[model samples]
Target: MDEVEKNKTVEKDMKKLVNKSWFRYWLSAEMSNSYERLQSLSFCYSIIPVLKKLYPNKEEFGEAVKRHLNFFNTEPTWGSPILGIAIAMEEEKAKTKQIPGEAITSLKTGLMGPLAGIGDTIDWGTLKTIIYGIAVTFASSGNILGAFIPLVFTCLTFIIGRYLTNFGYTVGKDSVKSILQQGWIKELIFGTSILGLFMMGALTSNFVKIITPLSFEIAKGQTLVIQEILDSIVPGLLPLCAVFGIYYFLKKGKVNYGVLAIGIVAICLVASFVGVL
Candidate 1:
C-alpha cells in the first residue's frame, strides 16, 4: 500500500476506535474492579476496542490485554484522562512498533498517584463537602430540595470526566506536564480544600449530637445542669470531642471501619441507657 492509503486507513481506524459513545461506556465501566487488580481489569476493558483495532494478531492482542491487566487503581472520575492518554500512546505504538508496553505502564503508574490525590481532594473532599453542605441546610429544615440538590450536583462529575478524557486524547502524553503546570488548577485545588475544611467544621458542629443531662444540687431548690455549664464554657464541646476521637481512631488504621462502626453504635446505646446522652 502507498503511504497515502496507509495513512488514510490508520486515520479511519483511529476514528472508529474511540468516540463519544465509547467514552460513555468507559466512564460507566471504569469502576468495575476486583480486590486484587482494583481498576486494572476495567481499565483494560475500557480500551479494548482500541486495542483490538490496533493489534490485529491474536497473540499481539492477548499480550496487550495482559499488559493492561496489571495492577492499577485510581479515582475513576479523574482517571479518565489517563485512559485517554493511554489510548493515544497505544495508537502510536501500534503504528510505529517502537514504544514498549513498559513505557505505557510506567506512565500510568506515575500519573495515577498525583491524579488520584488531586481528584480525591477536589471531588471527594471539596465538591462533596460544598454540595452536601448546601443539601444539609435544606435537609435540616425538612425540605425535599436537599435530596435533589446533591443528585443534580453529581451530574457535574460526569461532565468533568467526559471533558478530561477528551482533553487527554487531544493533548496526548503531554497532558500530565500541562495539567501539573497550570497555576490556576493548583490555586483552585487549594481554595477548594480550604472551603471543604470549613464546611466540615460547620457540619461537625451542626450534626454531631452529644450532650449531658447530669445535674447537681447547688442549694435548696437550685440545681446546676452539667450540659448547661458545659454549654456556657463552649457549645458543641462534646460533639467536637466525639468527632476528634473518632477521627483519631480511624487515623490510627488499626481498627477496621466495621469494628469502628459497631463500637460507636454500642457506645451510643450504652450511653443513652445510662442517661449520659
Candidate 2:
C-alpha cells in the first residue's frame, strides 16, 4: 500500500483497537458509581450497527453484542437510536471513496433534531408513562412493583434493541441510506414518535394519580380526598400539566436546567410545607 493507504489502514486498525477498550469499559457496569465511564463513550450503544461492518466474524459480532448488552445498566432510550445513527455513519463511510466532510456534518446536524425528538418522545413520554403505570399498579396493591420498574424497562430495551441491531446490521449500508433518504420513512418515524407521545400522555392522564386532602367550606361539611381534588384539577391532570408548564417556560425563555430544577424543588418544598403534596 502507498503511504496514504498505509495511514488509512492504521486509522481503521486504531478504531478496532479502541473497540476492545470500549468493550471493557462497557462491561464494567458501574453506572452511578463511575459516571466517567458513561461520559467517556463507554455507554455509547451506537457503536453496535457499525461493528458488524468493522468485524465480520460471528465470534467477534457475538462478543461485541454481548459486551454491549452487558456494559451499561443505565436507561438505553437515547443510546439505542444513537447507536442507529452510528451505524448510519459507518455505512456512509463505507459507501464513499473519501469521507465527505459535508456528509459527516450533515449526519451530525440531522441527528440533533431526531435525537431530541426521539429521546423526549420515548424516554420522557412513552416509556416513563408505561413503566410508571405498571409500577403504580403493583405498588398500590402493596406488591412493591415499583422496585422492579427499572429492571422491567431494561429487559424491554434489550429486547427491542436486539431487533434494531439485527435489522440495521443485516441491511447494512444501502438500507441505511434508503432509510435516511426516503421521505415516507422519515414521516413514519415521526408519526410513530407522535403516536407514542400521545399514547403516553393519555396513559399518564388516566393512570398516574396523586392524592391529597381538601375541604369544601361553602357547602355542608365535606372532606375531599386527594384523588377527588385531582378530579377538580381536570381528573388526574395537574401533575403532568405542571411538568409540561415548567418545561414550556424553560424552553420559551431558555432557562437553564439548574434553575428549573431549583424551581421544582422549591415548589415541592412549598407544597410539602402546606400539606398539598
Worst 10 residues of 2 by lDDT: 32-41
Best by lDDT: 1
lDDT of 2 at 71: 17
Query: Which runs of model 1 end up more than 4 angstroms from their true locations?
Result: 1-31, 173-277
**lDDT per residue as tens, model 2, 137-166:** 888888876778867766665555544434
Instruction: Give each model's whole-structure lDDT.
Output: 0.75, 0.52
What is the model-wide C-alpha lDDT for candidate 1? 0.75
Measured against the true structure, the TM-scores of the candidates, in listed sequence, are 0.56, 0.46
Which 10-residue window in model 1 sums to the lowest lDDT?
183-192
